[model samples]
Target: MISLNMLSLSLILFSISAAVFLLRRNMFIMLMALELGLNSAGMAAAHFALTNSQTEPVIWALLFFAIAAAEAAIGLALLIMISRKFSTLNSDEIKELKG
Candidate 1:
């Protein structure tokens, strides 16, 4: 049986993620919120997989991990390049070629 508690927890997580994504003006905060949303999705997939005795949830979790890793790598690279060129990491202050 699908539990109400699980559903409520999922809803709460999604709500928090949405709020963080909307409320945060900083690029780093937004990235963190995006990660939270992806993690909650992985959690839901794993829960469903456990209940069904299927392997799909684990696969989904692995996919999420891969995606997170790629995202982190790209984001960190971008931040480094930006800081090197602009001398700042603030999203609001990044300029393309005005340095």
Candidate 2:
């Protein structure tokens, strides 16, 4: 019932985030889309854990969230540095990164 709805919503969010991540060239937008994708995965995991009466999935989901947070922090820091150095948020314009 509710689990199905949660899973459906999670799938929708994941799809949207994936599309945003793939289609957008801005570093900040990509970072946000990545975060949204990770969060949606965590949400699905948590929902499944609750439906199955299991603790392990919930713990894994929490760990996923922590990892996502760290990723977001590092991503933002890199984005800031990149923007400072390149003066642009568009990933396509940063050709100096290719090596």
Candidate 3:
């Protein structure tokens, strides 16, 4: 059963994630927001699946969760490499890629 409170909480999380991803300068926090958005989306999908009695959305949500985990791992690795080289996690300050 999908409660109204769960829906509201998911909506709030999605909105906060969007705000953090768009308005924040720190790469680490932006990555965190990205994960938050992924999880909220997964929650919404699961809720929808439960309300509709469908298995597809639940599977899709699981896929999203897997992708979120991969994204977090890769993002953290990149963040680590970048921070070691630049000494900061600010997206604006970390520009200029070197090949």
**Candidate 2 lDDT over residue span 1-99, tens digit each:** 899889998999999999999999998999999999998999899888979999988998999889998998899899999999889999888887556
Give the per-residue lDDT digits (tens) of candidate 3, residues 4-86: 66777889999999999999999999999999999999888878887788999899999998999899999999999999999
Order candidates by TM-score, high to low.
Answer: 2, 3, 1
Model 1 residue 18 CA deviation (Å) reads: 1.8
Model 1 vs truth, CA RMSD? 3.4
* Higher-TM-score candidate of 1 and 2: 2
Give per-residue lDDT, candidate 1, residue 57. 77
Name model 1 segments beyond 4 Å from true.
Answer: 1-4, 87-99
- Among these predictions, the greatest lDDT belongs to 2
Off by over 4 Å in 3: 97-99
The candidate scoring highest on TM-score is 2
- C-alpha TM-score for every candidate: 0.74, 0.94, 0.89
Give the local distance difference test score of model 1. Answer: 0.77
Q: Estimate the TM-score for candidate 3.
A: 0.89
Tell me the whole-model lDDT of each prediction, alpha carbons only.
0.77, 0.92, 0.90
